[model samples]
Target: MRRRLERHLPRALERLAHCIDQVRMWQPGQFNYLNSSQYCLYLYFLSNTIWREERGDEAVGAATRLFLLNKALNGIDLFYEIEMPEVFFIGHSVGIVLAKATYGNYLVLYQNCTVGKNHGVAPVLGDGVILYPNSAIIGRCRIGDNTTVSQGTGVINRDTPGDCMVFAGTAGALVLKPATHSLVADFFRV
Candidate 1:
């Protein structure tokens, strides 16, 4: 694993650098191998780089191994194929499951947050969307930019207006309100 990661380190580090740069709490040029969050991103970057570089079985095997390693160590289900933005933040990597959805830039996900599909249709999240702990966005929904899915809230098969807003409660009885402040700004530099 170390050899493979080393072989792919340059490209992976380039991608990880783009991601870590947007985070406010992280120092410039910081990539800690011992930090689980940073390592999780590194593994994802390596897996994705390998997958994008070739279609051979060896590539697939290596990517799958890296993905599994990330899942095993970080408890995150971010696949190599998921096109995560270059400037997103993972508050807590554990128990976060992201499906094949149209994620936007500056996406923020906390522990136990889920972005999944329903009937083969995925959600389309706009820029600066934040999924708080235990929140979910499922199926054919268009989550607007700077939208905050409050803790324990679930937006299933609905659309949110593209303004600074907060979503609370389940899909059937969602409560939408203008967000008081920019939650994304707190997590990211932009």
Candidate 2:
């Protein structure tokens, strides 16, 4: 696991660097201190997680401590910063909160979805996960691959297994079925 994570670290760092460059270009001088502050916070989060997985024991205490410090210093009302795999945002607006511990790939989070910490628990999302507008997933939970969390759905303390369809209702239910590719492709046809 450590080896796999180590291999991906360079790519993650590159992405972070790219984001910083973009921010620098746009703001010029406004975000100098703010950018460094956020960068340090993100680095602290990433390093501790990596260290815990690799060395163990030594890295366990740093993440929580740093997170608390970040919140106190920044005066931001929201807590939780999402660390995502290599992916670009198609569109993003303000007021987005993503938890540090959540793990996922190819995630697309539209504006206003709060992926937050629920009693120090973080969500584990699978690949190709899309959280539509106003969707909130909190606590220790797993949302499966290829799943679309519809708008205004709040999920807590649950697991949506792989290849399943989740819908809201009085008695909310999930159906496990293979995703059909051609059906999805039809939606893109001009």
Candidate 3:
């Protein structure tokens, strides 16, 4: 694991730096290796890079180890094969499950949020989407840009329009209204 990390850490750090630099809370041009969120993303990047760059069973085994380490330390279930966006934010790494899906740029995910698949069909998300705590986007769905899946709202097998705030309606329904403000800007400078 140490050797694998040493070999892959450079690419991971570069990716992590690019990601955290866009966040408003993180100081520009600074990447804290000790920060848990940063470290979690680092591990993911390393695993993903290994999975993408290396070949043979050794690469798969190394990637699996890195993935497991991140899961054990951060409590996140982001697989190495999951194609996360180049620029995204994880508010809290704990209890976050990201399945294989088409992720958009500037995505935000809070604790206990999920982006899952339904019957092997994953949902596609647009740019600048936010998934609040305890929220989920499951099955064949197309989430529009600048949309917020509000806390505790579950969007199962449904599609949402662009530039809206989503809320849970009566009996597991989704209520989407045009967004008045920029929620993604609060976290990302972009």
- Candidate 1 lDDT, tens digit per residue, 1-190? 5666677779989999999888898886899888788888898998998888764788788899989999999999999989888888888899999998998999988999999999999999999999999999999999989898888888889899865555574445888888888788898887
Quick one: how many clashes does candidate 1 have? Answer: 0
Q: What value of lDDT does candidate 1 attain over all alpha carbons?
A: 0.87
User: Regarding lDDT, does 1 or 3 come out ahead?
Assistant: 3
> Using TM-score as the measure, which candidate wins?
3
lDDT of 3: 0.91
TM-score: the better of candidates 2 and 3 = 3
Regions of model 2 farther than 4 Å from truth: 1-13, 16-82, 88-90, 171-190
Q: Would you list the C-alpha lDDT of every candidate in the order shown?
A: 0.87, 0.52, 0.91
Ordering by TM-score: 3, 1, 2
Question: Which pairs in model 2 have colliding backbones?
Answer: 82-98
- Tens-digit lDDT track of model 3 for 46-129: 899888877558889999988999999999999999999998998899999999999999999999999999999999999999
**What are the RMSDs of all candidates, in order?**
1.7, 8.9, 1.2
**Model 3, which residues run further than 4 Å from truth?**
1-3
